[model samples]
Target: MVELAETVSDVARSEDRKEFDALVQRYHKQAYNIAYRMAGNHADAEDLTQEAFIRAFRFFGQYRRELPFDSWLYKIMSNVFIDRLRRKPKAMIRSLDQPVVTSEGEAQFDVPDNSAGPEETVLSREMDSRIQAALDTLPEAFRLTVIYADIEGMSYEEIAESTSTNIGTVRSRLHRGRRLLRNKLKSYANQLV
Candidate 1:
């Protein structure tokens, strides 16, 4: 990574396109999700993700291999996506009303039939939808930190490094972000009861 980071300013960095390609292959999904987590829509995610990789390659020399390469890449992707999103402030709010897209084309959430009435079943599903919406409503930085640390299963140190934030801020953001999400979710909690 030290060598890679040096590549950023060192005019004579490694010219091995294959090596960089390999790195891309390894992190494509990770990068895409960070974009998705930041940008929300698949179309925007695709564009932002591609642009991030392009930017990374353009600045590959700055990559410090001593640090985690994945973290650096994620930071780049998150920043790019968030920046693009920042340009379209209205888009983010409009996206909240967008439909949920579940992977595998099937619902993973099961409304346990613990005597759930038809109304209860519907309410449960609505709550689930609202939770997803609230998550999307969160600010990009807070959302990405929480998604990486919780949904994507990254550690605090990893998240902090990726976001260029300190561990304490990472923890604080995660806590506050979830708290805000819960508050948003509470608006629909009556449906749960």
Candidate 2:
């Protein structure tokens, strides 16, 4: 990644379109994933990701080379998402079959046991729905914190850098976010049974 970053930095400094394209190719999928988590749907996620790249390109000259590119991109994406939310906040209703796009390929939430009964499938879906709903209820700060820390598997320090906040703030937000999620999910625990 260090070599890749250095190459990207060099290309970006030279203002070469091809080099920029390489940078985009390297990070677009991850950007889309972050946007997908924030937007909660593919269409909006695509739009947000595109907008983030456009903004990143437009402001590439202003980007500090010392900072991690992904962190810088994530900051742009986070701001884009926040602006969109302010303009129009909408509920996310994801289909059960929606394939989550990942580097490995598309994946979906599934029962571990292939022979799982219909009842088990239904229960799994319900649980997933409940958890998503609970997540949706959180404030953007808390939601993004949880998404970055847990869903995206980013470390607390990475999250802090991406969010432009100190590690202490990141930890606090994560703790508060998880507590809220736990409380929200507890209410639906009996329904899953």
Candidate 3:
């Protein structure tokens, strides 16, 4: 019945356990996706979200009254992601070596296939798989921009703030990231044909 902003602000100001729990209940799943976008993996996403909440809870007292709580929470999430990135050893995206294949007509990555000849149905699945895989190749900043704008349907300004980048950077990253994805998909379009 309560709006997320009010609930979060109250909990932050008062340390209201019930209100805070409601905030968690409402935002947990959505927060997970944000973390996943930033972290680029399931395991890391979970950790990032949990860490964000822990950090946010610890400092809820300091949350400003006029600011939207989700934005504040998201700011905390950004810190968590940056910290995770700094702490972990940077590694190449793990999906590039894998062949994107699927029984369905859609796929995430387009790997060179020796399937002899795949039917339209097979190709569709492969394309879908290749698309997803190609997406995973992007850097966390670019990846979060794409997911927030395209998948979550946030505005450029919202994504820029959530990502701690300027709108120009968000636009540039989204444009460049999508181009890179399309090129990745183009590699296996022959399979679709």
TM-score on alpha carbons, each prediction: 0.67, 0.67, 0.65
| Leading candidate by lDDT | 2
Write down the RMSD of candidate 1 (Cα, Å): 9.4
- Cα displacement (Å) at residue 113, model 3: 24
Give each prediction's root-mean-square deviation over alpha carbons. 9.4, 10.4, 9.5
Number of colliding residue pairs in each model? 8, 0, 20
Clashing residue pairs found in predicted model 1: 1-64, 1-65, 1-66, 2-65, 5-63, 7-61, 8-61, 8-62
Residue range with the least summed lDDT across 10 consecutive positions in model 3: 114-123
Task: Give the per-residue lDDT digits (tens) of candidate 1, residues 1-193.
Answer: 8977676635554564566899989988877766665665677778998999898888886777687777778778767866877787556343334555677574334323323367645444545556656778888788888788876798998888777889999999999998998788775656645
lDDT of all predictions, in order shown? 0.73, 0.78, 0.73
- Tens-place lDDT per residue, model 2, 1-193, is 9999998878767765565688799999888867776765577778989999999988877878787788889888778877776676576655555788899999985533322467645446557666766777778888888999876798998888878889999999999999998897786667745
